[model samples]
Target: MLREYLQALLFIFIAEMGDKTQILAMMFATKYKMSQVLLGVLIGSFLNHGVAVLFGSLIGGMIPANVLQIIAGSAFIFFALWSLKEDDDEDEEEGVRKLGPVFTVAAAFFIGELGDKTQLTAITLSVDAAHPFVILLGTVSGMLLTSGVGIIVGSKIGDKIPELFMKFIAYGLFLVFGSMKLYTSLPEHYINIFSVSGFIVFIVICSAFLIKPIIDKKKKGEKSSYQKAAMTLHDYMNQMKSNFDNICLGENKCGHCEGQNCLVGYTKDMIKEGIEQGTITNPIETDSREVWAKKAFDHAKIVDSLKFTLKYLMDNYKDLQKRDMSNAIRNSLEMALFEETLEFHGDINMYLEHIKEKNPFIMEELRKSL
Candidate 1:
């Protein structure tokens, strides 16, 4: 029993490491808790291997060896096809099952383990009669150890592994095993044709799986380009608003403004003070008082600067086709800066603050576009 136990343990554990059920274990780990999935695998294998050992010899005798091989071979071939057809939870993973996560995992593991090579091997190894139950124990331990590894590793690398590709490799193994069994069981003359045809089909299936992700990414790249452009525009506007806030230094000490108050009126006196502070430039100078006033940053000049910013918004948004978005930004600026009247504060910082509040939605829209 000890020798049988070690043999079963070693053989089944090694066989399972590269099996589809191992991949399934990894997949389940991504959706459910690792502990729960491991428990499910253990329970599922215990039940499956126990039953397989109990009926091993009886089933073998009932069906001739050649017929049994063909039956098992054909079953795995169907399994390969079914595995390929089963969709993975990539792109958008679903929430945990309502059917109780442990039970869901256990049921899936049990179902998937049926007619699998490891289970068949368990049946064969158990035919010795005396230590059938012992063989079952060893196999269960082996399966649990292997499945535990799958669950742990899958949890770590699930995001990086392409779900469809993992399924293909798993299914490919099953297809190869199935075809080999079929080839061995069939008469000699039929071997070459069946072997060649199965090999071609498996190659085609694996190639398709490998290429599908690249094609899908290429398609997504076109849409993401638009999103990238939109995000870039949104980010640029935010940066420009930051530049505007820092455009002047005033007595306010915030570096945003040095005005006496946020509500200070735009006047020639204040403009001359700003010029002396280096916040404003003397664009014109003249002997006449009226001509000197023309160079000042006053109420009219403040309103013109605001209008210029609006035009800037529109110009930058020319490609978006959504003038409403730009208009919304403009409206926020009006509400924040000029809500009561064009009576301006000469301070642009408050205007920048308002735009910041309104600018968040553009980023939200950019995310949705992706």
Candidate 2:
């Protein structure tokens, strides 16, 4: 029993390396707290493996070995095709879901592991080993260990790993496993060297044809979004500059000033007032209104264009946050534009500087841009 459990553990552990379940676990860990995700995976895996072992023990005892081989072989082939068809967008969608950790992890794991290789391995281990309970425990232990490693280490390393390489490796494993199953079903005389070669070629060709275009399109879409974001940021800065120039030139009336107060002078006062009220504790660290005015003017046309562009883009894009564009730009522009507005003209305690500092990225950018 001990030997059987150890072998089962070893087999399952090896089988699970780079498996979809482990990949899904790592993906989940990236967005959710690790402890909650691990717990959910453990619970789901224990249940799935336990059920597989129980059924394997009972079913294996009744089915003829040859029939089982055929069924398993067919299943492996179907799984290989399914893996090729797997949607690459799942990781992105999962990352964005706002579901609580336990539900997210549990749902992802449960869907990911349905008819997965490790589950099949659990059934196989039960049939081969005398001790079904020990086999089940060993399989679960192995899965937990492998998946835990994937969650803890894989999440960090996965970014460095090439997606194409990972996909190829996964596909290769499925092809190998599927071919082996098919070979087992063939009669000894009919199994020729060419059969194995042909099977591998077929698997590779099918996988490449199915997944290559999808991968290419995804890459293209990402590149387009990145370019659009960069252009949008550039244009936004320009619009801010034009607006600043107009305000400072007295084209826009400063409510408190009888046509004498300039926007730049007014902004300087606002910054000073903000610091005094504790709303802006670090005015000295912020970029000067003059520097902001220069950049804003330089990018005026682009900035004007961005107002309309960003509105449409933001309305259509799900994750487009105003903060993500460059909070520093937004804050500086806001301070520059509204400095002369009536609400902030008096000796008000509050200032926009304090609100901007709350965002570290914006604060850092503001300092750098200054």
What is candidate 2's lDDT per residue for 204-286, written digit by digit as tens?
78877877764785565332221222233224434444444454434243233322133344434534433344233323214
How displaced is residue 182 in candidate 1, in Å?
2.2
Q: How well does each candidate superpose onto the true structure, as a TM-score?
A: 0.43, 0.53
Deviation of model 2 at 205, angstroms: 3.4
lDDT of 1 by residue, 1-370 (tens): 7998987886567566535677667655544677888888778888888889988756766767677777767765665655444332221112324558777666676777787667876786665435788889899989888788666654454334554554567466667877788878878877786677876787577657755654585466422111122232333344334433433333354334323223221223333433244232221111212321111123333334345444444333433322333333333234334332221122344544444464644323323322
Clashing pairs in 2: 235-302, 235-303, 238-299, 238-300, 239-303, 241-296, 241-297
Alpha-carbon lDDT, every model? 0.54, 0.54
TM-score of 2: 0.53
Q: RMSD, model 2, all Cα superposed?
A: 12.5
